[model samples]
Target: MMEVKSKGQQVSRREEILDKAARLFKQKGYVATTMREIAEQVGMEAASMYNHIRGKEELLEEICARVAETYVNQMNEIESSDLSPIHKLQALIRSHISITTKNIHWISVANNEWRHLPDSSLKSFKKARDTYEDRLAEIIRSGIDCQEVADVHVSITLYTILSSLRWIETWYKPNKSYNARDLEENIVNILMNGLKKSG
Candidate 1:
């Protein structure tokens, strides 16, 4: 008979591996963080990791997928709400920026480490990521039509908004002074007002 572990134990082990790998990736980067090193961090043999995942690349994909999937689902939920286009746009952007800060490493993994994956993995990852971006772009397009967001190139505006927030991962640190909500407010203000305050 097969041995059975409780679901909580399985989930905890998975989270342990994911969390340790993420920290290693963030600290040592993708190229430098070897599977052996990651395994050792969690007191397992490097080969034993294959029991949980195919390879290091898949782990990176999983980390990125978690954030991307969360954003896509959040976008879908926001879109279904009864709010006006302006409110929807504002609320979604706020939530999106907050999420970026919450899972800041996703930005680095998405932009930096994802390219090192195999072609098949890359394709799957790109599809999920692009679909998420397209949803955001669709919302931006809606905002433009409704005059909630300014009249600008839809792709450019969306990219600009997202790129600015994604760049935060490089320098952002969770602290008492500023936080995800503060970043969201700043982004909304920049979208609404120019650098020069009106008299």
Candidate 2:
């Protein structure tokens, strides 16, 4: 029990460091943010911060890689499910909204500051992101084939949904009138039905 408790505390501190770094990275661009600023945000000395983290680049890489991996893993699961294309699409949208809202700062940094990551990490992040987008496009293609989705440009539709979903962190306010569930439903309804009215 003592060993478990000690490990839990270590994990907690590591998470705290990442959280503070994410906020700083989002507020100030990743290049502008420093290890000292992150340490200051978490009320720790710069030297002490190193005990939990290697540096700001590692923090950015960690957040970017973690969030990217999560989206890919979620997509993998959704793709394998026996659900219809439309249902799978809805699930993807809903999951995107939910995760982004919960980790707004992390997602913001990952989306915007991922370029600052080391070359190897940058390549991996982009590959994961592209894979996720391609899987989403596959779902759209499946929908088109099954006549569930209208015959729209698959790439355009995928781009529209992915871009809009990614930008949710820019405008979504958790305690405001529009909550996650509302955002998910509204996005699905709007994207599925589109701007044109029925006759």
Candidate 3:
């Protein structure tokens, strides 16, 4: 029992460290953040920090991988759903807003700092990102074929929607006049209006 409790505590502490590291990485780019700074933020000494995490690169790789996996999984589910192309796009937008709002720091770090990942991890991350975009583009293409979406360029449409969603991390604040749900609905309405085929 005591051994199990110790292991649980260690896991909790490691997660706490990762959270702090993510916020720091968001505030001060991954290249600018130091392990000692992360240690201080988590109220641990630099040496003790090493006991839980190997180094800054490890923390970064974990954070980036976790967020990327989440997006890829969500995309897979949305792509496989029986919803129409328009609805699939709406669902995808909602998923992005939901993930960004709930894990702002992690999302920000992943978006802004992923380029700093080591060679192999960087390659993997890019592949996942490209695959995600390709899947999204396919949805738009299907929508166009069905005449559910306007005949816009798939890459342009994909990036336009993505760029708007990605900017949420810059200005989004909780407890503001607008909430996540409200933001999601408004964005969906606006983007959908633009994409929906007109007479």
Candidate 4:
């Protein structure tokens, strides 16, 4: 029982360290953040941090990998669903917003600091990102074929939507008046209106 409790506390401490590292990485770029700073934020001795995590790169890899996995899994589910092309796009938008708002710090770090990941982790992150984008593009292509979306360039449409969504972390705040649901609805309405085929 004592051993289990010790293990649980270690896991909890590791999570706290990761959370602090993510916040610092979001505020200060990953390249700018140091392992000692992360330890200080988590109220741990600098030398003791290694008991919980390997190093700063490990923190970054975990953050990026978790966020990438979330997006890829959500995209897979959205793509496989029986929803219409337009509806699939809407669901995709909602899922993106939901994940972003819920994991704001992690998402921010993952988006802006992932380029600093070690080479192998960098490659894995890019592959997952590409898979997500390709699946989204396929949905857009389906929409165009069904005449539910305008005949715009698929790459342009995909990038436009993704770029817009990606920028939300820059201005969005949980304590702000503009809540996630409102943001989601407004974004969905705006982007959908632009993509929908007109008479």
List lDDT for all candidates, in order. 0.71, 0.81, 0.88, 0.87
lDDT string for model 4 (2-49, tens) is 010113435688888888898999888888889999998999899999
Per-residue C-alpha lDDT of model 3 across residues 90-123, encoded as one tens digit per residue: 8898888888988888889989998899999999
User: What's model 2's lDDT at 112?
Assistant: 89
| Lowest lDDT 10-residue stretch of candidate 3 | 1-10
Candidate 2, residue 141: the lDDT equals 90
**Where does candidate 2 stray beyond 4 Å?**
1-11, 195-199
Q: Of the candidates numbered 1 and 3, which has the greater TM-score value?
A: 3
State which candidate, 2 or 3, has the greater lDDT. 3
Please give the distance, in angstroms, between residue 129's alpha carbon in candidate 3 and its true position after superposition: 0.4
Cα misplacement distance, residue 79 of candidate 1 (Å) = 1.7
The model with the greatest lDDT is: 3
Model 2 reaches what TM-score against the true structure?
0.90
What value does the lDDT take at residue 69 in candidate 4? 80
Per-residue CA lDDT of candidate 1, range 84-146, in tens? Answer: 666776777777666667666655666677777678768877888788778778877776677
Point out the worst 10-residue segment of candidate 1 by lDDT. 1-10
Q: Write the per-residue lDDT of candidate 2 for residues 76-172, one digit (tens) a residue.
A: 8889999999889888887887778878888899888888899999999999988888888988898888877877888988888888786687888
